[model samples]
Target: MTLLRPQIDPQIFSALTPRDDFRAIARWVEPRSSVLDLGCGDGSLLALLGNELEVRGFGIEIDEKGVLACVQKGVNVIQQDLERGLRLFEDQSFDYAILSQTLQTIHRTTAILSETVRVARECIISFPNFGYWRHRLAVMQGYMPVSESLPYQWHNTPNVRVLTIHDFDAHAHAAGIQIIDRVILHKGRVIDWGQNWRGSLAVYRVKRYR
Candidate 1:
């Protein structure tokens, strides 16, 4: 899948990303907490979370274009290669660290997740769910699904790994990271998850024991 939808035109703001997602995310973030955003992309979520949550926010992004976008948003951005792992920050340096949408692209999800737990009291991670029915059908039919969330073509897709909701849960458990909260996003709306498998996206708040 193409990480950046070149033909879709760059959007300054997307009402497509619902406030419900932010509201869900806001619940886990206390006001005035130091927040670090990994693979922060264009800082849309960081800027929104920072402004609404009243928290100091830092963004780490590897893409040059994304770094520029973060700068434009006035988000505190550090342009660095994340695949190298997080060794520069001190332990417990922030209240929360966020890894959103970019987890699938990382070569080392375990390392990055561990780093987030080590650097902050809490962590939030969100990604496209590869096990959604549409994805299942597509794979069964021998074609990669191009849903709104997973909009990349398989040949040039940026996602190195595709994980399901259960897969993420298992990995988190193995890492000893507890799930503090979970939310599923679908068509930009937060849905009641008694039917959450129908949703296209999942967000999780995670933390370590100590």
Candidate 2:
């Protein structure tokens, strides 16, 4: 399968300043807790959590360049294809498993979510919200939306499934995963209202039902 590298913001590559979405996820993590970051591009978020929260952090990345970047930053990372699944990790091995901005690219979203919730006590997930007004307008206009959060044209996009926070909430409920926290963002600003149609991005903290 041909892997498409989504266009990442240059700010995501920065070491000093963490991205707002990363920060939002970070807030859910407890200090000194064990964390597994799936698709941890360049290990920026893991590094941030490691430094700020003093967590035991491991990462999984498929791209060799991203793996090398993680190693250079002293992050323990395993280069593996997530689509093949995460059976290697034992259930409840980590305090948290994170799929930040990588869920849309995954073909087996349900399977991955099941495994993630099973392997960790909790999971933190972030993604671009397809229900944003811009995306809705683009669809109505017969064009795929391209914006800062989702910066790709339809033909070259890595996102196989585009979903909104509302969609994800429904999926989580049906899957028996409980959402513990949610943060919505529009143009980098945190918003509380109209998340389904106005928010461009969102982060969710969830755990499997006991």
Error of 1 at 164 (Å): 0.5
lDDT of 2 by residue, 1-210 (tens): 232223333443355567769888988999999999998988889888877788988888998998877776767888899999888889899999999999999998888888889999999999999999999999999999999888999999978999988789889966678889899997778988888898999999999988
**Clash count, predicted structure 1:** 4
Clashes of 2: 0
Candidate 2 residue-wise lDDT at 17: 60
RMSD from true fold, candidate 1: 5.7
Give the runs in model 2 whose Cα sits over 4 Å from its true position: 1-16
lDDT, candidate 1, 43-160, per-residue tens: 7777777666778888888888987777666677887888887788898899988887878998877877788888888888888888778888999999989988898998989999
- Each candidate's lDDT (Cα)? 0.78, 0.86
- Reference-based lDDT, residue 202, model 2: 94
Best by TM-score: 2
